[model samples]
Target: NAGVIQTPRHKVTGKGQEATLWCEPISGHSAVFWYRQTIVQGLEFLTYFRNQAPIDDSGMPKERFSAQMPNQSHSTLKIQSTQPQDSAVYLCASSLGAEVFFGKGTRLTVV
Candidate 1:
């Protein structure tokens, strides 16, 4: 079990550009979740996948946030037309239930 993996630990994007973050969940885990954390928002759930299928994305922005799981090992979150307000830590987590593990997170800075 690799726990969780997130890449490009940091990202900087121009306002109105796009940013992509990646995540790899632990082996044999069937549930994956995405979250955004900041001083203002605390932690907000962006989306979740169970058994490689999207379960809910109510917390995601209707305009620019998207998440996907193409396989059992990995997931991705993409933000388009990034804005300064979008700057935050994007975290990915996985779990079976009641016990979830989080990735180190990708810190995004939109300037």
Candidate 2:
């Protein structure tokens, strides 16, 4: 149990560039979740998976945001043509029953 592994803990992208955040959930945990944190939103749920299957993505942007749970241990969040508004801390979490564990988060900055 590494909990969740998120790559590129800090990423700086130019306007219009893209950002891809990665996550490796805790082993044996049946659920993985993604969230975005900002001064205004605090923590907003982006998407989630159960048993490696996508469950809900209503909080994601319909055009440039996407999330995937490719296997039991990992998930990804891709944002295309990122704007300054997209800059935020992206967090990943995993849970089995009532306890949920979170990753350090990928901080994306679009300059």
- Tens-place lDDT digits, model 2, residues 81-111: 9999999999999999999899999999999
lDDT of 1 by residue, 22-57 (tens): 999999889999999999989999999999999999
Identify the runs in model 2 with alpha carbons over 4 angstroms from their true place.
Answer: none
Report the number of the highest-lDDT candidate.
1
Q: How many pairs of residues collide in each model? A: 0, 0
Pairs with steric clashes in candidate 2: none
TM-score of candidate 2 versus the correct structure, residues matched by position: 0.96
Candidate RMSDs in order: 0.8, 0.8
